[model samples]
Target: MNVATDFPLREYNTFGMDVTCARFVQIDSADEIPKMADLFDTPHYILGGGSNTLFTDYYNGTILHPAFGGIEMASQSTPTSEGTSSSSVLLRVAAGEPWENLTNYCREHSLYGLENLTGIPGLVGSAPVQNIGAYGVEVKDCIEKVEGYYTDTMQPFCLTSDDCHFGYRDSIFKHELKGRCFITHVWFRLSPQPRFTLTYKALAQALEGREPTLDSVAETVLAIRNSKLPDITQIGCAGSFFKNPVVDQAQHAALLNRFPDLVAYPTGDGMMKLAAGQLIEKAGWKGRREGDAGIYPKQALVIVNYGNAKPEEICNVYRQVIADVKDLFQVTLTPEVNII
Candidate 1:
């Protein structure tokens, strides 16, 4: 275990908020989990890859980070179906594994199902927490099970996918087990067979002429992401700050009448998910900046820090966006990124 006091967190969180935690502990082994129980005496937060996190100010508490890393093949099966082999592979990825690394691994192994989620940042453990999704695939679609220990009780537990109750960027981790569990591993079921979900319009159009192979699909997904989201390595920003607002069919019809160009997707329950970026862009906030903080011009869904944005600046921009968007669309834009 590595411990530090008054640790700088600028590099830890993607938003690049200049902040510090009272204590920062990174454990490399599950054996240290028991030791962490005492840390709960003081307020503490579990941190992953810091991709989907925004630190609004100094966190005057312990920040526990699990650094254990490994991706092991736990099982594999090949069933013959009318002379055709339906091969499947199961991988157990440690929480500390970079999400991109997992996607890359899939490509290397010719694994299907993670291609569309290629460029998302964060750790594998964090994947189920937010039910991370992109293109046309959500992390829940590939997750077989999640393994972790409840921080409050220090009892290890594993939950099947059905128990996760995943829904549009949400899972048990964010609610039922919120602030109570430290995820240690995630199990994913992948296949060698070539199966693709190009249902998402943009992704489909982008690959119009090209064949949809694993490499091609992953590369295309990354390319599309690069065109919109700011590279976290350079600009300071969470990919998409707001969750795409979902509305009832009646509301969707009302908005569609006023704005024919409105882009939306049906959620199979008369609920239509509106494109948040389009809404923000139409609100005339794109490329707009408040001092150092601004919505990324390429995609209005992102709030970025131009070198040295203060926490208040970021808050100001997003708040104003919500207020303005609400005034115009009557649709509430909620943040997808966790603000701490």
Candidate 2:
């Protein structure tokens, strides 16, 4: 266990808010988990790649960062109870592995299922927590199991896909199991057969004439994301600050009548997912800035720090955007990024 005091967190979080943690502990491997009993007694923050986190204030507790890293084929083709070959491979990825790195690896190996999730930032451990999705694909669809250690008992546990209770932008890690465990690794099932999901219009249009393969699909997704989201290296921002709100059919109908161009996607259920960005843009907050914080003009869903913006300034901008959207559309917008 490597420990540091008054650790600078500006570099740890993608938003680039300058903040400090009281204490920061870096666990290099699962073997170090047993020695961290003292940390469990107090409230702590588990940090991954920090891509989806916004630090509204300095954290006063311990920050636990898992640095364990490895990736290997955990299982090969196996027969199921029905005597049919599964035709899938299980991969064990360490919690600290960059999410994009894993996607690139799968593409290079001709693996399917993760191609659409390329360009998403963060670690494998954080993926299940957010149930990260893009281009018509969610990580939950490929997750087989999540391995972690319970903070209270310091005991290791494994939860299968069904056990995760994954929902849109959510999982057990973000709800019932939140803050109770430290995820060490995750298992994903990938297919050998060529499978492509090109339902998203932008992606389909990008690959109009080209044959869709794992590489082509992944590249297109990355390109689409890059065209919209600001590069974190150049501009400090968290991608998609707000989640697309899901409303009942009646509310959807009323809103659609009011705003003819209201962008929405039917949930195939009674609910309709309204585009949060469209609401913000319509509310006239797109490209607007307060202090040093501003919404990315290209994508209204993103909030960026122009320079040395304080956490409160960024948060103020967020609040104003939320208020404007709510007042204009009578719809509530919730943040997808974790605000700390």
Estimated TM-score per prediction?
Answer: 0.96, 0.97
- What is the C-alpha lDDT profile of model 1 across 241-340, one tens digit per residue? 9999999999999999999999999899879999999999999999998889999999999999988999999999999999999999999999999899
Q: What are the lDDT figures for the candidates, one per model?
A: 0.91, 0.90
Q: Provide the lowest-lDDT 10-residue window in model 1.
A: 79-88
RMSD from true fold, candidate 2: 1.6
| lDDT of each residue in 1-340, candidate 2, tens digit only | 7999999998888889899999999889988887788888897999998889998887999998888888899988956799777688899999989898899889888789999999988889999998999989999999999998998899989999999999999888888888899899999999988888888889999899988998889878888888999999878998999999999989888998999988888888878999999999999989998878999999999999988999999989999888888898898899999888
Native-referenced Cα lDDT, model 2? 0.90
Q: Which stretches of candidate 1 lie over 4 Å from their true place?
A: 81-86
Mind sharing the TM-score for model 1? 0.96
How many residue pairs in model 2 have overlapping backbones?
A: 0
